[model samples]
Target chain A: MQEIPKPTIRRLAVYYRCLERLEQKNVEKVSSKELSKMLKIKDSQVRKDLSYFGTFGRRGVGYNVKELKEKIKEILGLNKQWSVIILGAGNIGKAIARYKQIEKDNFKVVAVFDVDKRKIGTQITPELTVRSLDELDEFVKKNKPEIAVLAVPADAANPLAERLEKLGIKGIICFAPVTLTCSIPVEYVDITVFFKTLVHFISRGIQ
Target chain B: MQEIPKPTIRRLAVYYRCLERLEQKNVEKVSSKELSKMLKIKDSQVRKDLSYFGTFGRRGVGYNVKELKEKIKEILGLNKQWSVIILGAGNIGKAIARYKQIEKDNFKVVAVFDVDKRKIGTQITPELTVRSLDELDEFVKKNKPEIAVLAVPADAANPLAERLEKLGIKGIICFAPVTLTCSIPVEYVDITVFFKTLVHFISRGIQ
Candidate 1:
């Protein structure tokens, strides 16, 4: 397989969501131009990115919405269920655990852990309880979650990520504001970056 | 003076943060190579991105960390204070309101509003309280927040954004998992996209 650029990977996920939205609206087919207009992406760029995976759309008929959605789902590994563990019981962690869409999207929140003893044993969701970080070693050995969601503090994120990588975690979805130096894939969900982008545009009088 | 690419804008923010960390550690100077190594960006890419703003640094002496950080901060509009209103009082909204870093970053949570009657009048922080969405019109009229944060449900995001645009909101930082169609700039904080990225990498055995 050809190496896909990271931005293209992100755009593929976006295309999947856009198609999902189209399906919900009872739309059956979409042209690259239509998709690009909806997403503000270039039509040629959309075609080029999708071609990295495989051709789907016909010459004039465009692509079948459901078919393309499912194909991108498989390409993104969203077709299979993924077991996930949340590493904080803070607002972000609890919110993610309580997010119904996660289960719907084939990602399961198998467990939640926190360093706060006061939060330990507390129920985040009826199906999930916050566990002590001290129990992480035993728990990981037993349940073996594939992904770890880091919602911890900036200072703690790096060391925790190192441990999670050592424990064989495949990837991390980090909500912390720090840079992680783990060998495993770390997706930093730095909300402030979005804020910075907003300020930059606002200051530039773009709006 | 030039039209900076959106990706470069985001990178400027990243460079500012990385430099801030260095300043905290009393690091006085850094080369493009050192910054790129810390950020996982290409050295030439760093120099090119920074050059879009202005030329800095002397030959073989590296860039003064404090001077470069301040310059990027000014370029990104982080030097000026911004008034912000969050439109949802749910977990994400509350977390963002309660975040102490916002004030540090020069963005103030001037107000928070929600559609839920039960949540209104609740204190999210010692300084901020949740107001009814019904009061959004008056609040925007009276206070004139430059930015509106959309943390509401996906379905509610678009219409609310339309209302905000009409109310003279400069820009938006949206946390809802939906495509917002507004005349103003919208910065989307789609956490699920990050999840999709992680799953893609994990499934591809990239780590």
Candidate 2:
């Protein structure tokens, strides 16, 4: 099996979001040109990116919005339920757990964990509670959650990440400042870096 | 001036992050090749990206860590203070206002706004208060905030964004699902899409 480029995967994620919007607006068909214009990418680039995944569309008609949305979701693994857990119940962690969008994308926060004894057993969201950190390995071993949102503080991040990896977590949405050295993939959302990047965009006068 | 490509800007953001970490650890100098490997980018890409900005180093010495960090910060506009406002006092908005990282980047949240009457006049953070949506225009016009964080719901996002642009906002860090069509640049952090992208990365066998 050939590996898809990361940029294409990122763009596919963007395309999926666009398609979902189109579906919500009751839009059925979307041409590559239209998508390109909306995404600010060249029309050819849009077509090429789409082609990398598979064929979608026929003759004069463009992509069917609902079908394309499903295809992208399936390609991105959103078609199946992904049991997820939050590694902290702090401000950012709780915010992510409370975020409605996570649940909408079929990524379920099965539980949240915190080292604070006071936080343990407290409900972070109605469906999820902050469990003790001690229970994490056993819980993950039993539940086989495919992903975890690592929202612990910087000092705790690396150690917790190692523990999670040793416990066989497949992916991590890390909010902490620390970097993890695990075979499992980690998607970092370093707020300082992201905000600084935003500053850079505004500074460079925007492309 | 030649326009720097966005991927370079994004990588510059990554480099800035790496440099900050290096500075924290008291590292004084770093070669482009070393920085490139640390960032998972090619060595030439690092040099080329930095060259897009300006000259940085001498023959054999490589980049001076503090000087390079400051240069990147200046290039990214972190040297100057940027007045910012939050468009919603919702969970995400308040979390962003209190993030502490934003302040570290020299982006100040001057105020927070919401359509809800109950939320208006309430303290959002130690420095910011929730204001009425109607007050946003006059406030922005008076304050000249360069950036706005759009944390509003999908339905309200478009209108509020237009209002913010009309009030002369230079950039937006939009969390809403809705896309804004303002001439000023917009950086999106659509959680649903981002999480799904993370899912795709893991699903694709973790590059």
The candidate maximizing TM-score is: 1
Model 2 agreement with the true structure over A40-94: per-residue lDDT tens digits: 8788888988887677866579899998888888888888899889988877888
Over the stretch A1-207, how does candidate 1's per-residue lDDT look in tens digits? Answer: 876777888898889889999999999999998988888888999999889868888989999999999988988889788999999998889888987767877899999999998999999888999999999988998988999999998889999999998888999998888778888887888778788988898888874
Q: How accurate locally is residue B148 in candidate 2, as Cα lDDT from 0 to 100?
A: 91
Give lDDT per model, in order: 0.88, 0.82
By DockQ thresholds, what CAPRI class is model 1? medium
Candidate 1 residue pairs that clash = none
Give lDDT: candidate 2, residue A144. 98
Off by over 4 Å in 1: none
lDDT of 1 at A33: 88
Q: For candidate 1, what is the DockQ?
A: 0.72
lDDT of 1 by residue, B48-165 (tens): 9988867786768889999999988988889878999999998888888877767788899999999898999999999988999998999999999999999899889999999999
After aligning candidate 2 to the native by TM-score, how far in Å is the CA of A67 from where it should be?
1.9
Cα deviation of A168 in candidate 2 (Å)? 0.6
TM-score of 2: 0.93
